[model samples]
Target: MELGSDLNAGEITIAQYLKDVGYQTGMSGKWHIGKEPKAAGFDFSVFFKSNGTYYGRQINDEGIVRKVEEHCDLYCAERSVDFIKEAVKKEAPFFLFHNTQLPHMNGDLIWDARKETKERYEVSEMPVAANRLDDLSGKPEYLKSVRNLSQAKVYGYPDEQAIQKHTRDYYAVITEMDEYLGLLFQTIEDLGLKENTYVFFMSDNGWMLGEHGFTSKVLPYRPSTRVPLFVIGPNLKPLDLDQMVVNIDIAPTILEMAGVLLPDNLHGKSLLPLLKQETVNWRSSFVYEGLGTYGGALPNLTVINKDFRYIETFENGTLEKVIFQEFYDQNNDALEVNNLMGSAAVKSKVGEAQKLINAHKNRILKQ
Candidate 1:
């Protein structure tokens, strides 16, 4: 889908809003939001719009385009530590957003990791996803398109052979990233910021290692959308909540932690209550939107709740026709091999999913 122009100060970012409340803000990581981090009111920032290289990445600091030869994860960790040491000297509250660009596709369309890390996960040791050998007969036509299968074809990712070759590399990248994070964690403990900082960990999206015989994201499948979420803070016990959470909730959760007022127009609510182990009413499902054109899957909407996965494919937004519908009983079909849409007993369940889609459309009209 098309996005608006670059973000400006007219609309305050989370970093900018935090700065207004006397908190020094800084960020170091990948930012593809169509605006410079400095323009968003970050006190100090360092990033290079790299073309998928792990070393010799270019950086346009101010107006100077310079290059650095550090591994991306190491480079980011160094910068984050630098900012933390500086913030400690200032003797005030600070917000640091340390993002990493790892376990993501590189020039070869596969995740890149250190050679040693990759060697640790032998191809024979890799575990293929449950739906690695899925046949797309029950899925929409768009999912079976050659264009959408580009990544999968690059490494035989449509089956277990693909998982053996690619998933190991992906895990290696993540494990290397985890090592660098240990450095950041040490910095936090060394600087005594552990108690005050509430670290939130999440991914932009999940990946599919041959899930449903497909690779890459933008599908209505569980492996394509179920990202990991982790929260760590002082005095906070680990409790996994069953509520549906999305990336949009990150801002509201952070704002609530920083005591900032939430903007009413936000699409997600703060997860702070749930994080605190509070018994509160929460959403049962979330809408997974997939908007695409050439080289991507067809436009679609999916609602994944506690017990079901419902998908509706569209004709690329022209509203010419709905290709079809799919429903999977999560409780009985964790692998999503069974399409429950045609079941006679679950007519009401199908209707409920349709209602969610209709409600979202009505909300858009009101906006």
Candidate 2:
């Protein structure tokens, strides 16, 4: 149940809570929360690394390894389907984390369900959070200061034809995921379990095929930080939450959804009240820190407050360099082009944000 990255990226830790709740918890595909699956506390697990083909492979569950003959998509989906069948047969509330490797990258597998045409894939439109060119339209000076401006240069777009081809493969994976999701949803509906089952669909983080002259998700840009979130259930209303919600909020949301009491030690906020349309005050700022050993030695610390984002990059003992410090009036420049951090008018605001980030770190330490 432990995904490699954040809880939102994959259903890693959420799966752990499911097992803790006495549900028949099972996970298949990329349990990357830690080097060992047992560390995350899962009854059944399938772990994979970050490289190579993400499909037609094997997953290690407990101490035993299980071979999957099908592509990665089918491999995970089928296992989840079987879990659901078993759960229904046993009248047990099952928790199945069917994490997939599709629509992520290194496209070798071709999935018809995920893509239809070259154009759909060429633009990388299949991703819910594709990089928008409009975001970089302004701030010519900032763009110039940053290295690697071309899409082809940044995200390895390859040739025009190659990008189109890659896009096709990417879309195929997305479509395949969408189809499997529909199938899973249908199963619950057909079994008359719609009222009880809650389905949450989201990407771990935004994947960048091109936009912003960037490729992967290590950056603090919206294309990487923003994730698509949707919860569908019988009584849930369709709502778009503009309020800032970080990946940390997910753990508590799932815990609350399962009708479990919030563990006081957890660092996430439950979205149960939000789901019920209760006007509860939520976290206004999202603190982002890409610290730890992953994503190379390029470390970054960013804080996104009401209308400003302060990004500090460091290497070894070098002083912190303000790679990107901007304040965008969400009501106006939502794309975040204005670098108000450099302006004298916003010095006080910038100082306040720094204090907030410092306080946040202190709170985490005290916890």
Candidate 3:
């Protein structure tokens, strides 16, 4: 139930709906769905107090701090397993959003991996992923700040070795999570409810893996918005939705799957038909936004269609003039190494995208 990309307020927090619908909702791992999990309707949560860290996790049991410990993911998985077992005994359907913070960075696991990988890349040598903003040192009032590890000096800058080590460690965590997901699947099967239960596995946002000379998950780049989303359940037919699907659509899709009527106010349309391998008459483009300037305020907007993507960054203080524009033709430069925003033909596409963005924004705000 990593409902929407932004773990922030008012962005289709599905956990709230899960709890409201009488589903025993339990969250293990990052509960970045605003400052209060209990208020958001999570029954039990083992969340991190802050971002970037694995050793010594903070737990909140319905709003109260319960405990903290190292090896957070392992503990979280144990608790989740227990919750599942209990839910089975109670004869109730359970919704567990196991959002892992592990591949996120600044954790004991990272430190361990650094040592394990024998410092392959210098800390400074590695650059942020393309989707993240760089150089936040000047703006004190910025929403977020991006900082490379202090240990970068050891890597002799260009931290290739460090980056490689981090990548390996991140994959290791994913492997561990995959194993847990496998267990979860097994548990569902063992309980004879595999056919009925719906499970979605996806990343909240795409991570910067040394793409575009930047790192992090804030930029309006493809790596950030293009998260991997997959579903395993009874109703959903296996099919890849190659066309653009925004994060906002997820809420309606889940609601539709559970036989719940989608709210008319939601900005997204139900993706149930698409999941069933049915042709859906939907929009060709998706609108995207992320943490604003500083780290969270530098307003960025994007329109991604099946064939092309256009992104615009507004000046920090003034949201009027476009500071930068990037255009990528998926058919031609699939890697997105080249920018076509400057071309005359590309400008026409951007012009169209602007109208699409305006329409989406108006529709959502009106709702």
Shift of residue 15 alpha carbon in model 2, Å: 4.5
- Show model 3 residue runs off by greater than 4 Å: 1-21, 62-64, 107-162, 294-297, 360-367
Model 2 lDDT tens row, 79-123 = 666668878888988776666776665443233342254344445
**Structural similarity to truth (TM-score) of each candidate:** 0.93, 0.78, 0.79
Query: Global lDDT for candidate 2?
Result: 0.61
Q: Estimate candidate 3's alpha-carbon lDDT, on a 0 to 1 scale.
A: 0.63
Per-candidate clash tally: 0, 14, 23
| Winner on lDDT (1 vs 2) | 1
RMSD of each: 2.1, 5.2, 5.7
Candidate 3 lDDT tens digits, 1-367:
2332344456545766766677787877766544566556667676655455555656664456755565566666767777788887888777887766655665432434334343444444434444222333222222233332222323322355545555555565566556556666777788788777888777777865555434457666677678898878885666677766777787788877766667776777877777778766878777786425433437767888778878766677544666666788989866566778668877778889989866755654554
Candidate 1 structure quality by residue, lDDT tens digits, 147-187 = 54766776776667667878888889899889888888899
Name the candidate that leads on TM-score. 1
